[model samples]
Target: MIRGDLHELNRISWNAATVRHNSHKQDQAGFLRSGGSTLFPEEIELLGEIRGKEVLHLLCNSGQDTLSIAKLGAKVTGVDISDEAIDFARKLSSDSGIVGSFERSDVYPWLEAAIAAGRQFDVVFCSYGALCWLSDLAHWMRDVAAVLKPGGRFVCMEFHPVAMIFDEEGVPKYDYQMPEPLHWDTGISDYVGDSGGALAVSGAENVSEPFVNPNPCAEFPYSVSGIIGAVLDAGLELRIFREHLFSNGWKPYRRMAELPGRRWTMPEGMPKIPLMYGLVAVKS
Candidate 1:
């Protein structure tokens, strides 16, 4: 499929997922009202002390993490492809009294406009399931570099590509070194709220009702070298690269054990695999 068509399909699919994602108790509006953040501990530590910094959050669904960063005293601007997600994010920010800005646009075009407007940020932050949506990592990283000030930092924490090759049954379904984009026509949505339960709160009439997506989506599975090499080629110096054995959410395999922080790992006697990774690079 063409990149534009894939993006549009993903937009629709993600918009559908956003409604359910926002309603879930794990990401409930009230939880955000009480100063809860969706950020993992590793992400928080890597972005240590963002007070008074200008931060750009790419693929910031519903602005949960954006507001969290705002609470840390950073000026934040969140960019997302889904209008519904941005709308809910704006509402959440308003309802929670956290100050931040949001824009609805594909990341590449948004970054291009930011560069044209001479806007630069102290930090460019992205994470979790964000990178897989892009078809061109080099262009993406170049734009990332373009939007950052000299000596600025780019921090990304995401599901490791190695883990993405496995199916729900823990079998390897794709090549870890596959160079092309993968397409999936599965009608099921991957949002946490789809796990089955009533919403934690009511009165979200303005938001769309949750529903399953029947559309297909395409994603590019990039190797660690491909990702890091793109960052380096974009003129950013690598600061840190780390991998973790646990995922950030529910296990893909039923037999896996749940760990603290909503993470999941393999059961006893099973070989451990890196499920998540974080990268920090600086623009020199």
Candidate 2:
């Protein structure tokens, strides 16, 4: 009951966050239409050869990255819990002329159904802020392995667990080994820093007022060891693991600076810490 309630609250919060995130986002269709991709280089490199592969994207918020994969000639399906995100993803896919599918379902049930249905994919990709929202990686990784074809690969690029220990001011906040859900009262809002409400691209009205969503959010934290153990326990062979100094894209801290290729990193004179981690594991 507690887990279900947590998912419900987060689904509602993300539904609210998606609207604001979309508004700050500029020319999603136009950007893709012009051969631009939202995927960072790390994902591209980790994905290896995705062309013509069947790919499943878990918790694909708004299908932005999933569509980017579709644009690369992969047959991609994105699954998310937020109906608003899936709705917008379909619209974006159509508007950008990219062929892909998006489904609105909780990832656990969707994965179970996919496994029971014998639906398997050549690749399972989840990236950036993906792992924190999950209450447990053990169940998640087990189902993920079940949904992958034999010899299929799982590519993950997520914000490093250590990054969660710090506040925006470079001060330590949360513990890195938290194994339970953390309830947050502050409403999820635009992380893109768009205070001036504006919609980029065609066919949307630009509003100048800032949007507000009072919905609280909940997230779970898994230690680095916990994440690695789950994947290994799923019987997948861990092939590669890397930690990066720069973020995949989002600037979570005010003290950080953006570098080329849209990545962000801590400023000089600060200790260089791992902001993100990536891994590639293959079902054996």
Considering every candidate listed, which one attains the maximal lDDT? 2
Best candidate, TM-score: 2
TM match of model 1 to true structure: 0.91
Kindly list the per-residue Cα lDDT of model 1 for residues 1-284, writing each as its tens digit. 22777788888888877766665544345666786676778899888889999999999988878888888889999999998999998888887888899999988788889999999999999988899888788999999999999989999999898888888778888898776778778632644542222122322232334555776777878899999999999999999999999877645665777776567788898899998999999998
Please provide TM-scores, in order, for all candidate models, with all chains considered together: 0.91, 0.93
Worst 10-residue lDDT window for candidate 1 reads 195-204
- Report the Cα lDDT for residue 166, model 2: 89
lDDT of 1: 0.81
Overall lDDT per candidate, in order of appearance: 0.81, 0.83
Count clashing residue pairs per candidate: 0, 0
Give per-residue lDDT, candidate 1, residue 237.
97
